[model samples]
Target: MKETEHSNSSILKEIAELLNEETEIVAMLKGALVKFLNGTNFETGWIFFIDAKGRSELVVHENLPEALAHKDCHYLKKGGCWCVSRYRNEELKKASNIIECQRIESAIAADVGDHAGITHHATVPLQSGQERFGVLNVASKDTVRFSEDELALLESVAFQMGSAIKRILLTKQEQEMALVKERNRLARDLHDSVNQLLFSVTLTARAGIEMTEEDTVKEMFKEIQHLTQDALTEMRALIWQLRPKGLENGLLEAIKVYAEMLGLQLHVTVSGVLQFPSRIEETLFRIAQEALNNVRRHAGVAEAALYITVTATDILLVIRDEGRGFVMDKNTKLLSIGLQSIKDRAKAVGGTADWVSEIGKGTELLIRLPY
Candidate 1:
């Protein structure tokens, strides 16, 4: 009883620690898994989360080989011992000695624990209120298995573990839905505003070009040409705004369109495959927009390169301009808004943006994001 009380207090402290940490969700989850797995009483631990299709996926495992984790799956409704069975019933503590628990022999066999001397096991249902979140399974190589006291410790921690998982899953779902809604709203705005304005401008430019003679119309023609170019630029921007940014057709298409408009000598190139989340793609597009604006407004060079590559599951976006670069300290006052906006957008989506440039060697931007 004394040991059980101490374990309960320790678990409560862990829960408080998790709640107080200002780390990213992924890092927090990894930390939680580590603590759970390294619990003094268990030889192995695993956490299974339900995926989009309602199938259980092995999200975290400690001491379980990759071969077993990848090859097997557990479904909630299918009566799986580790995740499904625990959730179906109300019993929070299900621990058994190797000789007495014949029902779970197959699970033990599938886990390949017979040779590892994993004789004692326990499966605890992790729940937040009435919601069935997931399961935490712990095993011991010794036949002593889990005592009633140990089971009490697990029950104490289960509440905190379940709540954290529920919060993370709900947060991800809300983000995805919000992003889809925002995309729909942007589509409507582009059609209603940009499209109509560009159409009227195109008609006026065509009429001016057709009705003038060479001597008297030289200045008119120049003005008409300028209007035409402006209309084209606006049209391209609209298209960029509306482009369906899938993994295959996102950044490459944007760069290609910009290159065609700016001419072939601009030399835009993309390296490495990109598979960006929708929110990440939108931010990347905005970053590219700002970079191109800088190239056109301040960069006084003929060539620019947009190199994209993935390094260790991270997307690295490098936008380089062979133009005269300005000093950061001097330009911060003038360029603060644009630069700050870009940096904030990147950070919001778990990314970092940096710039490297000298006075004449050209400006290069590096945007790093999770892939």
Candidate 2:
């Protein structure tokens, strides 16, 4: 009797430990409840969450035979599930007699092969402070299987679950707010840089237009068209940069968009065969954007090519320009900001940037980094 009592205490302690270890509220509760059911020889268990849209969706369901799970999905969406009305009305403290009050007696008891055996149900609402997260459900073959002690244990588990979920939700909300703030900051920078540059270009073209010659008028019109197109491209680029969501389309897609925008605006035939590390795709995308922006500004050449190659261990980017080469001098802001930005970005991710140029020849920026 002493050995049996000690073993039972150990099992209870293990269950408590398991419950305490989960960081996510729903996951931990579902795991503990499922383990409790499976360990104590119960038939099935489930966890459901009340979504923002007030829909009672299944979060986790375990040991429920395939047929029952399938049926539950249908019922979870429809009003067929026992907890539907309870969840909809926010009645957490209601009596756990969902199945006992079932109107569909024959439908509930119908045998769906091996899965039809489980009939008894006990549901406990997962409450955290004043808010209710969802419900914990357990089913058994034997009627009246849940003792008062078991009910208390289930409620305790739900309480723990609610606390964890509350913390996670708060953290996620804070993170989203921070992301919105950062996007706003980037938008301000883009407006200041691109808009200011276009304004200057507009003033230069207007001055050229006032010159009294037919050839001068044609040249000024071309300049105005080029500057206007560059401004539009810059606006598109900034919009994409500030989107702040969904990397599923990945870095290569962003790069292609950036390159296409540059090709449409600039006199250069900007083209690239870009491929890079799965892990460093974002970094590579930023690097390419910065490099191209520099090409559009300082590289007065009408022709440039961007080539990206991925190898066994590293990704390489080469942006070459047949433009008026830049002088690497302390007075040169373009060389400093543009090259330094690429260099620092590459270095931040354990990469290197090599800039090769002469006064009248051309310029080539080569970046190599581990994937």
Candidate 3:
């Protein structure tokens, strides 16, 4: 008994170490599951997260018997079993052996074969404080029942796992809130201080140009005015990127305004509704601005068109311009078009960005993002 207790303590310590090291939610969950399976008598297991809306998402899974893993675990994928039902109804409050495993029973009825000596398994509800999140299921080859001591050890591990999950999620929310606060604060400071100073300089330079009598002095004033005006435009673009004031007016209008600011004309077409999730809206808006900047800088054209197709599951955006496109090489096209940055941004949002370009036919970039 003492040896068993010592082993459980070491496993718990190792799990705590792993949980502390992972900052991302999925990585943290995977680490917990791996540690749990590696240290316990259980040979196969999986974790599922039940959202506030009661939707179940399988987060991690480990080695299973061939029967249970058949057809990509078809029985596990769909839920109408006692475990899930008990979890949803708040009845699965403790770790205990689950009898009449419907999923395994179904597999057996179908003659999937190879139960590997397993007739029953254990189920535990994963929760933190008043917040209930998910369920953890574990089994071993041919194990008809799990001992009480083993169930207690599993519950202890699960309790820690649930607490760590809560910590990670709360940390992420706080960090996001702090980032937004800092961004807005910086944007306001820049607009009130540097942006205003540039506008004043531009006005003073214009006055100097009109008042000067000598041609040389007039030319100097003209240059000063032009440079200050250019500074103002760049400053505004930087501010917009930081806070995106135009985004409140919607993505299409925001792009139109930004393109005009860059001295380019924009044409837009849409095939679906305008509403989109907040993150998706921001991602696509930023990508659109980046594409338009590339158009004005390299395309040598004043006009661009955006074609948008919004569907039930995803959105597609195509930004195109008929200008002097560059050769599709590392030196000429990829670097000049800022392809890497666009691709990275899209990938972060679970999407893809690709471009089609030729020396004379201009370029078209397509971005597809799933909801």
Candidate 4:
């Protein structure tokens, strides 16, 4: 009576806190998982999220058995368990109570650990309306059946989780859309203003060079003209990258065109299919552009090669040049700006960048992005 009412109040308070949370989805999920455990007698729990590809990934978990934790149990890596399979098959549309856990059963059968202690659990679908997000599973050490009220409470929490997940996803989409609009606006402004001004400056410098009779004056005009031309090329490249043409065809095609425009010999090799999130593809394209810019301005090499490997779990990009390489050190400040930008871009996509360079040995830039 009083205890149940107190528990319900705690659950409601947690739900209110969850509704007010503005953190990232993963962090919010972790908080909600903790709240769920606090509201129930379950000693352990986990959440799985279904991605765009319909693949179930173990996104969060709490308080697993020592043996399972030691084994580094990854449900996605193991191709999911019975609850996930049933969820995918649409068999567990509502709160499933006192069901056998095949994962724990298998672990016990193989003498994996004291997993026999966890014989069964209650699984519920985290969904809102017709949209399904994933599943939430909770289990206890002692064999205890959940009551009807407890199951209803779990369903309510799952609903809130689903709503939060949906809101976060919508927020991300809005942010991405906003970013694209801003990029387009900046691209247009650069093309109409700075790009036109640079073109005029190039023309004026060339005319001045032709009209000047003094050799020194002519040389200065020539230098001005060269600088203007270089600036114009760089500006055009920036505009093109800001709103890349033929990106829909794919990143490889776009890179091929860019390399052609730069008049650099490009050798491209691709292994496996190249498909990735839009942000990741965009980041890789920008990094490749930066690498090519380095090759053009400093490499002193006529050719470069780009190797790309795409897998279900990760994407690898490698750009190599047999050009005049320079010593890299934080104190020296040589090409640090561009390299740092590459690193930042890789990090933005949850990836990493490595630069291998030595004087007279050329340079190789490697990037790995995991999805």
Candidate 5:
């Protein structure tokens, strides 16, 4: 008995260490599964998470049986398993010992011939207070019923996992809020300080141009006025991109405003409703900003067309311009900062950025992002 208690203590200590080392929920769950299987009698373990759409998803697993794994388990697919259904229905509120797994039972009833040695399993809901994260399930080949102490230990681990998940989620929300606050602050500072200063400089330079008598002095003042106006334009674009008021309406509106600010005639066509996660919205906006900047500096075109198509699973953005196009392969080593930024932003959001360009023809930039 003392040895068993020591072993349980060691398991809890190892779990604490693993949780401390990991911050992301998926990585934390994967590490916890390995530690749990190594330290306990449980032969297999898996985690399920209820996504934003309220779909039960099998996120990670360890040491799953070959029969189940070979069958490409149905639970891992889009639909929910019996355990998750029971949990969702509030039938299985705690860790319960079972004589059979619902998945195996269904397979047998359906005569799928995949349930060879699968039998009993236990499931514990990973929850904290009123929030339900998902479930932690463990199974073994032997049909031995789990002990009270064993079930209790599993519940304790589930509690820890739930708490960690909740903490991480809250931390992420706080961080995002802080970022929005910082961006708003920076936008205000730029508008009130740098933006106003540039306007003052442009006005002063124009006045000097008119006041100067000598042609050389007048030309110098004209150059200063032109440069100051250019600086003002760039600063305004940066400020708007940082905190676009139009974005509150939607991404399409924001892009239209930005293009207008850049003095580019924009033709925009958007299909489907505009509803997306904040991260995805921000990513698409950044990519569009970079693309438009490239159009202004390199494309030397006055007009561009943006086509946006939204679907249930993904968002596609295409920006095309009939401007002077450059050779991509020869200039690969000389890719501009704007182009690099566009590519990086797309990749960061699990998306792809590709373009087709031909010399003296036109260029098309395409970006696809999964929601």
Candidate 6:
């Protein structure tokens, strides 16, 4: 009785930790997995998150074996297992021990590395009411099956995790919605006020140039008109950044329009389908916009090239400029500011960005995103 009470106390404490709203979804899952692995008989565990696109992502894990953690958890991140298959089919309704870990068996078959004596695991489908999220798998060294009590505990934890995940996902959706609305509002405000004001200033400066008879005064007014026209174009660029109007047509078309706005001619090449998921299209467009801005502002050139290729699982974008390029060093701040955002955005979507350049040899940016 006393041992049961002690175990119950531990479970309650861990459940409370998992229920805390302070941490984001990834951190919470990592922390909770650690607690469970340390507090129980399990030696390793991992959590997978199924996105809206039905893609399985290995979000968090604790004490993963060297074999599974190899190459940044490449094994766990890919391949299908019995647990995942059952979960996808909505057949894994409770915590149950798998006959044998399919991934572990495959690894052993391929002689990847040591399995750390982990051969079997218990699979629990993470679900809140009717909405299923993913799978929670836990294993002990040489363990063949989970006991009744262990399965019960796993079920309870999975329930808590599923609830927490639901809350976090909903919160994210709401935050993104609010951000879109706020961006649109700011874009509209700038277009209606500052944008219009700059256009008026350009017209007034032009009138000044026409009315003046003295050459010196006329030159001054002409300079004013030129500066005001630049300012108007700058304002339009800002508005476009805040709320991209060209994306409605398509990403490639949007890039062409933006390049035109900046007085740039693009040499375009395409290798695949033009359609993409909305989120991916938006991110790619933003990255392209930034790259083109760098070419316009600092490349010392009037034309650039864009290459796009798409596949079922990945998309590659290459932007090149034949302008005077800067040395690849920390001191290349002329284009670094915008280029940094291009890299960061790619990483945000599980992608990579590579830059190739040399002084006076032109610049090339290559970005690859998992579609």
TM-score result, candidate 1: 0.52
- Per-candidate TM-scores read 0.52, 0.54, 0.74, 0.84, 0.80, 0.88
Superposed on all Cα atoms, the candidates' RMSDs to the truth, in angstroms, are 11.3, 16.1, 4.8, 3.5, 4.2, 2.9
Q: Over the stretch 266-345, how does candidate 6's per-residue lDDT look in tens digits?
A: 99999999777787898999998898888988889999999999887789999999898877558554546788889889
Best by TM-score: 6
lDDT of 5 at 147: 86
- Summing lDDT over every window of 10 consecutive residues in candidate 5, give the lowest-scoring window: 71-80
- By TM-score rank, best first, the candidates go 6, 4, 5, 3, 2, 1
Native-to-model Cα distance after best TM-score fit, residue 170 in candidate 4, in Å: 0.9
**What is the C-alpha lDDT profile of model 1 across 182-212, one tens digit per residue?**
8767867775777667666667766766776
Identify the superior model by TM-score, candidate 5 or candidate 6.
6
Candidate 5 stretches with Cα past 4 Å from truth are 1-6, 54-59, 64-80, 83-125, 142-151, 330-336
Per-residue lDDT over 1-371 for candidate 4, one digit per residue giving the tens place of the 0 to 100 score:
89987887788677758766755878888888887787677778888886555577677888887545546763223634766777778787788785566566665566655663677778899887788888898878776577787778778788888888888888889998998899899999999999999999999998998898999999999899899988988888888878887689999998988887777889999999887788788898899998998899889987999999988888999999998987766776555678889999999867999988888889999999887
Tens digits of lDDT, candidate 3, 1-371: 89988999999999989988888867887788788889888888888787554657677778777777778887677656677778887888999788868877877677786767666679898889988889888888878789999899889888988888889889988997898889899999999999999999999998998898999999999899899988888888878888887788888889889988988889999999989878789899889988988898789999999999998777999999999986765655435436777888899977999889899999999999976
Superior by TM-score: candidate 2 or candidate 3: 3
Q: What lDDT score belongs to each candidate, Candidate 1 first? A: 0.63, 0.66, 0.85, 0.81, 0.82, 0.85
Model 3 pairs in collision: 116-142, 117-142, 118-142
C-alpha lDDT of residue 321 in model 5: 94
Please give the lDDT score for candidate 2: 0.66
lDDT for position 269 in model 5: 89
